[model samples]
Target: MRAYERLLNYVKIHTASADDAECVPSTERQFDLARPLCDELKALGLTAEVDEHCYVRGWLPATPGREDAPCVAFIAHVDTVPDFPGEGVKPRVIENYDGGDLPLGESGRVLTVKAFPHLPKLARRTLIVSDGTTLLGADDKAGVAEVMTLLEELNEKKIPHGKVAVCFTPDEEVGRGTAFFDVLRLGADFGYTIDGGFEGEVVCENFNAAAATVSVEGFNVHPGEATGIMKNAALIAAEFAAALPADETPATTGGRKGFYHLTDLSGNVETATLRYILRDHDAGKLEEKKATFERLVASCNEKYGAGTVKVEIRDQYRNMKEKIDETPFVVDLALEATRECGVTPICDPIRGGTDGATLTRMGLPCPNLGTGGFGFHGPYEHITVEGMDAVVRILHAIVRRVSEMKK
Candidate 1:
């Protein structure tokens, strides 16, 4: 089957991961997609298995004379983001797009050319989009379908290629996709993550990410007698948020700029909580951002009481550029494959992190390849059938190139 057709089938499963769940996969629903993917890999004659943690791993041996070629791994994630409605996804296929404002279902949300200027460039292409109420799950599912289709093409066409490994990871949206990953077991010299946006985009750098949580403790008293005794935690939480640099936020920053994103906030008179994600391409700059959070918590504690406010911070992942730069050939191979597919490659730093970033740090030296997807993690998400076909062609090129390599 075609890659877009497989994407249509996979997005129907509710695979949104939980951010607060303490489990490895984060949610049980992730297995709903993982099991089917494992079965499909097995059907393709690859040795495949889904572990208890929901990681689907598959291996395909090289064809006859190509046994000496390097084993190349292709990776993608199964879980969608929890920030939006990922369940009940009803995809709408627009065969040969018109490059105009397209209405999505009856949800009154239009995918406008003004909001997404790239739409005009995609004229006459087959576009698949969501129904305006939920995310299209194209962020990484498009990658999954493209990889699956690549495997099918390799088998059917008798393509000459090296050993190939494919894995579908879970909970990537929640930043724990690689927590239980076994790099040595899959046994690849290097890998590429099919989790990037748009066609011909290759990501060698990503953000140095960290998550922070601020807790506020307040004393509650009756309103009539609360003037001197009551301390409002909710109000203090708001004050802390207001003190943050308005310009340094997700809405205000782009490109190589760093930002502090307030993801969740809830509070009452007695207790309050604020969750934030800090991101920067430079490790030193990311450290500065974390220190800013610490300073704010200290200032709040001084005014509200010594123990009224507290902050906890944890590092998520670092920029993969440092690690990827160590082995430059991995990125060059992807760029060469894209050009061979008749597409100009766009090498940019990802504003967000991917499983590739973590896997690269784990001595895998993996970079990211595009899935022909755009406007990820929200209702505006979309992909093109032609674009997916291009990615599959690129994957085929990569496999052939690997087969030709010496050792």
Candidate 2:
């Protein structure tokens, strides 16, 4: 099957990971993609395994004389974001896209150039998308299919390559993809996540990320007895949310700007809770953002009563660029590979995290490459035939160059 066909097939498998599973892979259904991918890798003549953690790992041994070459990896996550509709993902391919407002299947929602603005760049390319009822699952499914295609082509053309490793991880959308990843077992010197971004965009730096939960405890009283004697927990929770600057939010922020995103909220007159995600490229600023939220909570406690508001903040991931800067060779090599495929690489800092953020901190030094998929985590997600094909060409070039470098 072609790469796009593989994408359409795998997306229909319902691999949306759970956010509250508390397990390694976060969801049992992720195995839907993991097991088959493992078997397919073996079918492609590579040594592959599906560990208990729901990670699919495969290894292609180096050519006879390139034993000294370093092992490189291509990583992709299997789970679609849980925030969107994922089941029965029906993909439609618009061949020779005319660069206009492409209508998604009868949803009255149009993929407009005015909204996305980047839509025109995909003119004449085969744009692939869902029927508007569900997400296309192209966020990382595109990455998965591309890697599989690369392996298939390498075996078909008898390309001489080094110890090339491929890993399809689960629960990356829920931030646990690499938690149980056996980096030493995969044995990659460095790697790339074909996860996000527009075409030609290479993401090296990402947000210093954290998740925070704020809880408010309020005294409840009967309507007749409630004047000032009652403190509504929901009102206190809203106050805590309002304490953070509205300007410093995901909707208001853009390139390199930090934001405090309120992901969820739930509460009643007696108790309420708020869940937020903090993001910033600068580590120092990221901490400041978290600290600012804490201060707001403290002020709310002072008003409501001590211990009335409680806050718990946890680190999710850090900027991968810190480690990548120490090992620039991998980034340079990938850039050269992109050039070889006749595309210029655009280095852009990701506003969010990837599996690379976790792996790089684990000493793997992984960066992110574009999968030609855009509008992630929602029904607006789409990819193009020509765009995915370009990335495959770039992968082929990288392997050939790495093999040649061994000599």
Give Cα distance to truth, residue 7, candidate 1, Å: 2.2
What do the candidate models score in CA lDDT, each in turn? Answer: 0.93, 0.88
Which candidate tops TM-score? 2
lDDT of 2 by residue, 176-262 (tens): 888899989988988888987665667889899999999889899997999879999999998888878989999999999999999
Best by lDDT: 1
Q: Native-vs-model 1 lDDT?
A: 0.93
Residue-level error in angstroms, candidate 2, position 18: 2.8
Clashing pairs in 1: none
Distance from true position, residue 319, model 2, in Å?
1.2
lDDT of 2: 0.88
Show where candidate 1 strays beyond 4 Å. Answer: 83-88, 217-243, 265-272, 296-305
